[model samples]
Target: MILITGATGHIGAAVLDQLLKITDPGEVAGLVRDEAKAAHLKAQGVQLRVGDYRDPASLERAMQGVRKVLLVSGGADEDGLQQHYNVVDAAKKAGVACLAYTGRALQNPATLANELMVRHFQTEEYIRASGVPYILFRNILYMDTLPQFVGPQVFERGIQLPAGQGRVAFALRQEMGEAIANVLADSRCDNRIFTFTGAATYSFADVATALSELSARPVVYTPIEQPAFAARLHAQSLPEAVIQRISGFLTDIKNGQEATVSTDLADALGRTPASLQEGLPTIFKL
Candidate 1:
């Protein structure tokens, strides 16, 4: 059976949805902390296993008889890395043939200068050292995040962030999920690294232009200083940790860290992933 961690989450659910469309439902399983919450998945003939990344025994139990496992990275808290280690160690001990992980599409981890990317790099290294066949899905920023990053009043407030002219090869999260699912089901993808990115890259300026055309509204992109952005977030009473993460991401984008485009997503789906113009409407609920 193929077990997916974080199965109820957006990416995990999307991966399961894509997998069920091509593979038999009986061959798939989803790990959830509460079986009650996963009743919808159970109704779809998916075997539900109760597990938590914090509990290694639960992960071991969840991996019983599972040949493949997808380790969806956890949250940004201090325990996140340890949670990832728990999953990987459990997967290795369970004798799983293949372990897949979703990480950032960073070219150089040693000098990424971002805390989140660095943590992802550490997790990837731990999985590699486990000696289990693994596939690393290096995912880029999601189009879905545009709404959250820019906020609900994009056309009204315009775009103001520290991204500068840095471009991001953002793909729809659902499409990334589909590509990850396809890779998990195919042995040819095992032990390989895939960068899931859009066929093209776009800067915030390009995004503003696209929005103007799509919604027929006067949208503009303006660069903001990192401290000012942090202050805005602080005035909203956001946590310092979250502020740091958001600031770090904007800095990464400013440095052109996420600008690279790759064809791996398209190749896995056997079709071109949605372009920015095509995806923005859905992202913005337009």
Candidate 2:
């Protein structure tokens, strides 16, 4: 049996969808924190197991009879890391055969976002040290981020960012999830680190241009200083920590740190991932 954590989330839900079509419902289990939020998944025939990453006992119960585990990273920050470790420990005790984890793109030890990368590396290390077969999907930034960042302003104003002319290899979350499901379904996916990306690389300006075309408005890309950008986000009632983290990510983008694209996802899924154009309609509708 295969167990999927974070089953209510975007990528996790997509993974669950793909797994259902290829595997029997009885062979699939969903580890979710809130059973109420998972009513839809339950209706779809997934065996629901209520579990919280902070609670080791819950994880053990969730992992019962599970052969493969997909450990989706929690949403919170440092506390989330601890929760992930707890889940890994429980998975170890449950004697799961293979564990798959999500990670960042850069394998390089030196980079601005390397700190985030390190956390994922630590989880990967734990899975490896546990003597379980593991697969690491080093995912790129989500193409969905474009809509989240700019969609709100589509009708009122335009998009603005600190990413000066930097390019990013952003893949669709659905595609990433599908690639993950493909990996989990195949026995040969053990002990591999696959870097996932879209078919093309895009700059912030390119994103604004696409939005402009889709919305039929003058979508402008404005680059501002990191401190100023953070101040703006702060004025908008965003948490200081979130503002700082976003500023740091934009700084990394401006430094050309996230420009690499890969064919690994296509190779894994036997198909090309969705493009920005294909994803624009749904994103713009919101």
Best by TM-score: 1
Model 2's alpha-carbon lDDT is: 0.81
Error of 1 at 190 (Å): 4.1
Give the Cα-based TM-score of candidate 1 against the true structure.
0.98
lDDT of 2 by residue, 25-140 (tens): 88888999899999999999998999999899999989989999999987747777788789889988998888889877753546674355467777777878878788888888
Q: Residue 195 lDDT in model 1?
A: 92
TM per candidate? 0.98, 0.93
Candidate 2 positional error at 233, Å: 1.4
Off by over 4 Å in 1: none
For model 1, what is the alpha-carbon lDDT of residue 280? 91
